[model samples]
Target: MFFAGTVKTMLPKVPSTSGKMDIIRPLAYVREKDIINFMKHNEIQAMSCGCPIEAGKVDSKRKEIKILLQELETKNPNIKQSIFNAMKNINLDYVLGYTSGNKSKG
Candidate 1:
């Protein structure tokens, strides 16, 4: 993965995982000022990597879900405790395949 932008760019922070190696191996961390050098040093070869795009989509969906949750809370303020209880009981590790050192035991 090539992160090419200024530090203030809206790029999301890299996520942590339980795997032995990083899921997204950063090829280079390029700043805006070093863009020219970065382009020169890296060869333009594309295989098939949809991680960045998919990550963005997932991030957007998460934001949308957060908004919906906020709306639900606002509309049903009395059920806040129940919602919290439900969320606490839900375990997503196996569902998202991040259980047991990044392998799902389900």
Candidate 2:
């Protein structure tokens, strides 16, 4: 009886109850149509980005925009249109503001 008790104690314990299950909290999935609408509202290409990060005197502002665009794309592959649109807007903004020895007002 002692050997049997020792063996029993060595076994892992489990809950006797049934019907206990794990629940997962999921993020709300954005729809493609909603993503397109967001792009229209933001005046950006749905998947557009103008910033590229490079070593040696890299522009931090451009890097930031690039990171934001990357995050948006990584988080929602369904929003490719919005990503592209945002990129187009970035290019337009740059073109309108960029000039030699002159600061274009936003």
TM-score of each: 0.26, 0.24
Score candidate 1 by TM-score against the native: 0.26
Give the top-scoring candidate (TM-score). Answer: 1
Worst 10 residues of 1 by lDDT: 1-10
List lDDT for all candidates, in order: 0.50, 0.50
Residue-by-residue lDDT tens digits, candidate 2, 1-106: 1223211111133334473753332322454467778879988764434535354255675467556766887878756567445544655344434433365444
Candidate 1, residue 63: Cα displacement in angstroms equals 0.7
Q: For residues 1-106, what per-residue lDDT tens digits would candidate 1 score against the true structure?
A: 0233211222234445655544453533443336656566896434556776444545655466556767887878745467545545756653433344466554
Candidate 2 overall lDDT versus native: 0.50
Give candidate 2 misplaced runs (Cα > 4 Å).
1-53, 78-80, 83-106
Q: Which stretches of candidate 1 lie over 4 Å from their true place?
A: 1-59, 78-80, 88-106
The backbone clash count of each candidate, in order, is 0, 21
